[model samples]
Target: MSAPTPSARVTLAELAAEAGVSLSTISKVLNGRTDVSRTTRAKVEVLLDEHGYQRRGTRTPKSRLLELVFHELESAWALEIIRGVENVASENGLSVVLTESGTRHAPGPEWVEGVIARQPAGVVLVFADLPQDCRRQLESRSIPFAIIDPAGDPAPDVPSVGSANWAGGMMATRHLIDLGHTRIAAITGPADVMCSLARIDGYRTALNAAGLPFDRQLIRYGNFHVDGGRDNALELLRQPNRPTAIFAGSDIQALGVLDAARQLGISVPGDLSIVGYDDLQVARWSSPALTTVHQPLIEMAEEAARMVLMLREGEEPNNLRLDLATSLVVRQSTGPAPDAVRPLAAVG
Candidate 1:
């Protein structure tokens, strides 16, 4: 007798109830999420082989395209990430489709609906705060997703790729402290972002480690952009006791900090020192060449793309959370603290 195909006999819903797990759990077992325990995988595998079941449906699958969505695709930073994704996608014979969320940090309702209509094999979200409904919709359809540098906490079962943000922050801050700069300030990414919050925590931890008090006034939130860095740096510089060194959350912001300092006639690494994050191409070209923490943005993007492809091929990752290492890259923008520049009037 011939065996019954997935569409012919048992459905995933029936198998989920039989196994006493949620639909998502069954989907994870099929698509290969490493978070599922070994015992659970064995149980699901037994049932799958017993029933000769395969995936959610037995129909011919959707197109061989993968979706890459971003909050906003601008800046050299975004371009680097794009290049990584494109490299992997093209090599695997899969086309890439790019989407921008426009005004919001995550895709809107309309965007999600459009994705459902198109039904790509999988998705990669960069700096997106995945909405609960969006997650449910994708899971329901067995459309896998992996996040790159998620803006907020990702779903517990979802795979994600990012650098060691906390370590990067600590390293950047400690470099300044080691340079004998006691008056150090940090301009971090948005307050709501998970990576931003982690980076700030590392900053505070480093200060506390050095027996320095955490000064609330010295901390400011930027939007991971140049303007935000520039404006915030301007404010910090105008204070009566301006910081001798400033750590901007991103390279773009670091350049903006340099701009602000130039406008005030302050010399880089002479009157002031600057440190930035995400050692991008511009970081090397900035007037003084930025000292920064390398965040491995391209590598993370590439990993995310590869994960999506693996999900499409029905392979589980060896690990669910992949974090690349970050290290400090010293350049001309940083030096020993200046002796003469102690206080500031206002730079209007």
Candidate 2:
């Protein structure tokens, strides 16, 4: 028999006949059974794709596991996110399955295959956009997913959780401005990322609102790391008309700014002030505790997990994009700008 039309609900017998396989073999592939040979599975999957096949009555299938995928696990913030998801999982009597897959943008093909095989209740991805094909595969299988997007960029149609990066940036800068700092410099993440751009824009807006002139030379875009902060701070501090305060993209980067100030014999909060973002744990433990913008990472993760679970329950979210509010945490790292400048530290 010829393959059924795309609009028609194709049956296992039709798919098996089209693939020249037994009806049982078709069932195995549909169920993600690994007993089938690789070649046979590929052939079956291609035909299933062409036919828009999906298992009947399996949507919102009963499951007790939630999956959380991360592009990389090296950052300390990962723990906060894990704790958030674990909190939700515990409340719902579900288990969390953590996986490190793909890059910052999208997971690898193998990840989708593994996820399809596992058939999770729902999935939460951190900093990774789901590709269209992978999204289709998951949707066809009736798997719900959400993104915890700290980068502030996600697919328009996807449900995502993020913090108010622009407000965070503005608050950080405003705190410095409130400290009587006129010549303030900002060190943020890479130029291409939306979060970085939003934060910097907030900084500029704050400066303009406070009647402070915006200086292009005072702005530096670097990776969200300690080294990026230190290197950029070094250059900024060396200039004759150096800023008395600096706002960093991340708490880790703030540590580097502290390092750079120490190297230049500049006393933090005495001669210079500093502000950091994310308010990570390290911010509290720094030599001089960081004054920072709290991004509410744990809360954001918790919201994303809740969204995923809601989707699994066949509930539609009122909003596709949820941005949590960011607040400023004042600590010892910032103080009023010095009234009189100290002589420049000697640089070898």
Candidate 3:
């Protein structure tokens, strides 16, 4: 029945003075910089513990940092998500280091490893397709992480937060159907991505519900980029049985579809109706205006950041499969399917 002795408080300068090193050296050592000698590092470490001094306002063990890995920063989608993440992280007094995976081809493994080695309090994966090697490294280290718009086969242990892409797809298709279009085609992202597959499934689901046959020819694959959409749309238009309406998976692709339609001299909503997903800012500014399925990008990002913070604190997130709803925005680009017209000369 004895009270424990209060530990003495020590500052960085005090530690440096005792260890016979400069304040900068002490700061570098504490921050895990590699410039300090082993003897100096050891001496500083012993004093830090002896004084029971904790670094001001950070997670235990003095590293109050997190890592956020994104697929592409150039995209408005990613930028919105990052804004959400930054807001949450800042509110929580956590420092977040962001890195982009670049285009699908340039996933820098070294950068991921460096982040992992830094031993962040947690990690937020913003729409990046995690490789097996990276997944393995994260798992082995028991790092707390959450995937936003998870593309790979995520382990059950790690949670993910994203909009229900399949539902978004179904909603988009249904909107076209409600507008009196039956011959609807779909331009989708890479087959490897789970979101793309889910979207395809949703499209099929809507078609099946309406008793419409699922035509394989109507489905085209793209890289979720404008050029890919343009190429695929050109092929779709070339077919003898062209669709009256098209549902593009992303806003960027939808822009390409519009370009292709223009090149083919087809009038939007007159010859072809178009709808796109992601409801990005460009959708509003597009020439005929774009009807799109709106995903709550900012909310999704905020939720993912909150999830990472919770995981870092060893808290189980309540909603494992957070399926945010999607809304269909109506615009001038979509209308009733074009009607078959007889030649004026023949009629006369």
Predicted candidate 1 versus true structure: per-residue lDDT over 226-340, tens digit per residue: 8999999999998878899999999999999999998887789998899999999999998899999998888888999889878777789887778899999999999998876
Per-residue CA lDDT of model 2 for 121-149, tens digit only, reads 99999964677667767766778899999
The CA-based lDDT of model 3 is what?
0.77
Output the worst ten-in-a-row residue range by lDDT, candidate 3: 339-348
Predictions in order: lDDT = 0.81, 0.88, 0.77
Instruction: Give the top-scoring candidate (lDDT).
Output: 2
Which regions of candidate 1 fall more than 4 Å away from where they truly are? 1-62, 102-105, 342-348
Comparing 2 and 3 on lDDT, the stronger one: 2
Query: In candidate 3, what are the lDDT values of residues 328-348, reduced to their tens digit?
Result: 899889998778521222110
TM-score of predicted structure 2: 0.92
Q: List the residue pairs that clash in candidate 3.
A: none
| RMSD from true fold, candidate 2 | 3.2
Q: What residue pairs clash in candidate 1, if any at all?
A: none
